[model samples]
Target: MQVFTQDDVLRFIYNEVDAKEKKSIEDALRLNPSLLTLYTELKEVVAKLGNAKMEPDNSTIDLIMAHSAASKMETSH
Candidate 1:
């Protein structure tokens, strides 16, 4: 099995890579003890990023619409 780098783990989490590559990396993770430490760190980073909330789901669309409308109105005026 091949070893995974942090970039590989991140890409996997973000779905940047396809399922086939993901499975290969996962298999490597399961078989390699040394990969565990790097995997743990990557997992932490992924968790932190996941926890990030730049804006609430409901308000984001509303905010965008409001801003877009306002910009249009300003342009017309």
Candidate 2:
């Protein structure tokens, strides 16, 4: 039985863990109250992010492109 740390729980919640580790984390989640609470909060955040509709406006994109072009020119020089 592996005792997962907070980082491990976070990785599991974010789908960053491997299948084997995910199974381990899932088993721990079932019996750990604190991990369950943390998972719930992180899951809610992920859900909210998934529902988010964010798009940069044309002006913002232009500014970013201009900055990128300038940086490239500076590096090339």
Candidate 3:
């Protein structure tokens, strides 16, 4: 009857929990609808994040560089 938090679910998702906690979360996931729902949503988010591109695209980098160059010009004047 231990209540699990979102952090616990996240830890479970990332396999950061110990064996005992993992078992507890698995049991809770089966018996608790809300916890299961949270787990499912978090799992999807984790998957999406895992597949997400971590780097900014070329255009974005160019824009940032342009902005920085403009700032430097203004400061020099």
Give lDDT tens digits, candidate 2, residues 7-45.
888888778999999998999999999988988988898
**Candidate 2 C-alpha error for residue 69, in Å:** 17
What overall lDDT goes with each candidate model? 0.81, 0.89, 0.93
lDDT of 3 by residue, 29-52 (tens): 999999999999989988988876
Clashing pairs in 1: none
C-alpha lDDT (0 to 100) for residue 18 of candidate 1: 88
Q: How many residue pairs clash in each candidate?
A: 0, 0, 0
TM-score of each: 0.59, 0.64, 0.64
Candidate 3 lDDT at 55 equals 80
Question: Which candidate wins on TM-score?
Answer: 3
Worst 10 residues of 1 by lDDT: 1-10
lDDT at 69, model 3: 100
Report model 2's TM-score to 2 decimal places: 0.64
lDDT (tens digit, per residue) of candidate 1 on 1-66: 566787887787678888889899888878877676677777788788787777569888899999
RMSD of each: 4.1, 3.9, 5.6
Model 3 clash pairs are: none
